[model samples]
Target: MKGCAFNVIIQLRELFNVEGQTVKIDDTVSAEELSALGGYEQYASDMRLLGKIANRAGVVTLSYAVSVTLRHLCDRCSEEFEREYGYELTHTLVTSLEDDGGEYEEDYILCPENALDLTELALSDLRLSLPTKILCREDCKGLCPECGKNLNEGGCDCGK
Candidate 1:
């Protein structure tokens, strides 16, 4: 459940109005404190949300799908690689005249109009799915301390 005083329901019309209503998620999650894994960094480059609105059980349910880019540092080699953000998780809010539905199913919600913090939600997905160990490349050769060379480039004096 989203820990907030109230969740916002983004108007489907407004979201759809944009070229894709794809907002960046990199600015959503807070990552000041994270574990150091295999000497690399993990982050979300660009996370975006896209979806529509529909009525379910007489309540306005916002349907959404989000995507973003995940940057990881190679665990074996200190290299950086990027993975497209597939934050396709949809969230719903319940804003109604009475009986505020604290829970929902299938990304459904009840809102006053049709508005949501697309930015926040998208960021949330990005934060939740961030890789703990970032890899620059699946088969990165890392740095050669003996000569400071990228092993993936071939020919390292560090002795293969």
Candidate 2:
């Protein structure tokens, strides 16, 4: 899809009277647009659109639960690592954050005042699900501290 460099940002509030029996949002959220976000990395080949837009209750809540296959570089081994990120993402449409926050600790939701940029929403939800530290494995020996060679494959002789 052609992503407009000017209005790559979207406002969800623009979605009004948007009720569908089953609406797939992947079309709405473009991949090229997501790549533009700073430090944005998306691995999932597809986005699973599983949620509802309840314009009836004067609010729209979206639920996300999709598994993504991402190719990551191991911090230690410097090898390509394939990982899957799967989880449920939820958001509620309200007028302001003050309405939700100040009350209780809610997970993550969106406000109605702004247009619900599906692209931003997806990027944010995916970003939060990412791990702080990436490792090839739990017992990974990692690269040699001195020679900087991958120790998992036993191809380096750093101590010699």
Candidate 3:
């Protein structure tokens, strides 16, 4: 893969060499380029991935936690706010998949040529974990439909 701030390639050859071995990973993924993803204009900080890859009883697995602070506009009130999000992700690792016609494809992560781009995997997982509708708080009152006033602040003169 082309070298970049978020590209974290892990060599699986060494990990597979010894059974019951674990590899720790702690890295940051740059968020500047992710602004084009839509919804949010920027991130408060880079995404952090902390976890380990282990070969347990011949089954290789990757487990990690990703955390990041995002700057977003609350969908309800249209107020700008910063929120921290955390996601715990786990996946089974495999060097190759049996030809089952892609039946169980999504069950495992394929590390082609014994190389896995962890940052890419983590980013994908993070995106999937995000909420479809983002709100500053759980019980956001939202804005007044008639007056275009933020209800979270106070009620507007426009009744109903």
Candidates in order have lDDT scores of: 0.50, 0.58, 0.80
Per-residue lDDT tens digits of candidate 2, residues 58-124?
4556665655566678776778887776777766655566765556435545455555555556656
lDDT of residue 58 for candidate 3? 79
TM-score of each: 0.50, 0.67, 0.83
lDDT per residue, candidate 3, 62-139, as tens digits?
Answer: 998988888889989999999888988888888777633555756589886888888668767777777889899999
- Model 2, runs deviating above 4 Å: 1-33, 40-48, 55-59, 98-105, 112-114, 155-160
Query: How much is 32 displaced in model 1, in angstroms?
Result: 20
The local distance difference test score of model 3 is: 0.80
**Error at 73, model 1, angstroms:** 5.0
List runs of model 3 lying over 4 Å from the truth: 1-5, 33-41, 99-107
Between candidates 1 and 2, name the one with more favorable TM-score: 2
After superposition of all CA atoms, the RMSD between model 1 and the true structure is 9.0
Off-target runs (Cα >4 Å) in candidate 1 are 1-48, 58-60, 70-76, 95-115
The residue-by-residue lDDT of candidate 1 on 109-148, one tens digit each, is 3445545665555555556677665566556667787887
Q: Give each prediction's root-mean-square deviation over alpha carbons.
A: 9.0, 4.5, 2.9
